[model samples]
Target: MKAYIVSLAAGVAVGLLYNVIDVKSPAPPIVALIGLLGMVAGEHAIPFARMVLAHVTS
Candidate 1:
């Protein structure tokens, strides 16, 4: 569907932005995947943060 494609693009865009804005290091593929998942779920930016939290707490 068109919406799916849009969400996918948005996810990649988010990942790219993260890579640009984050001073620590380059964004990983997993980070992009999480962003994509967030897009699909209609969760905006919170899911990406949750993913990072999960990684850090693990």
Candidate 2:
């Protein structure tokens, strides 16, 4: 998706900027990735749950 690509690009730009400045990420790689995974899962899960609830009620 365009949004995903743009977000990825922005993240890469920020990462490169951080690298250029010799600044470490706020969170370690593994921790940050796990957090990202949780966020993605949560984003989908909430919408899916609502859809299921609507279907069951209808």
The best candidate in terms of lDDT: 2
lDDT of each: 0.79, 0.92
What tens-digit string does per-residue lDDT give for candidate 1 at 1-58?
Answer: 9998999899788778777987443545877979887777786467888999999999
**Model 1 ranges off by over 4 Å:** 23-58
Cα-lDDT of candidate 1: 0.79
**Residue-wise lDDT of candidate 2 within 1-58, one digit each (tens)?**
9999999999899999999999997856897889999999988998999999999999
Model 2 worst lDDT window (10 residues): 24-33
- Clashing residue pairs in candidate 1 (N, C-alpha, C atoms within 3 angstroms): none
Candidate 1 TM-score to native: 0.39
| Reference-based lDDT, residue 3, model 2 | 100
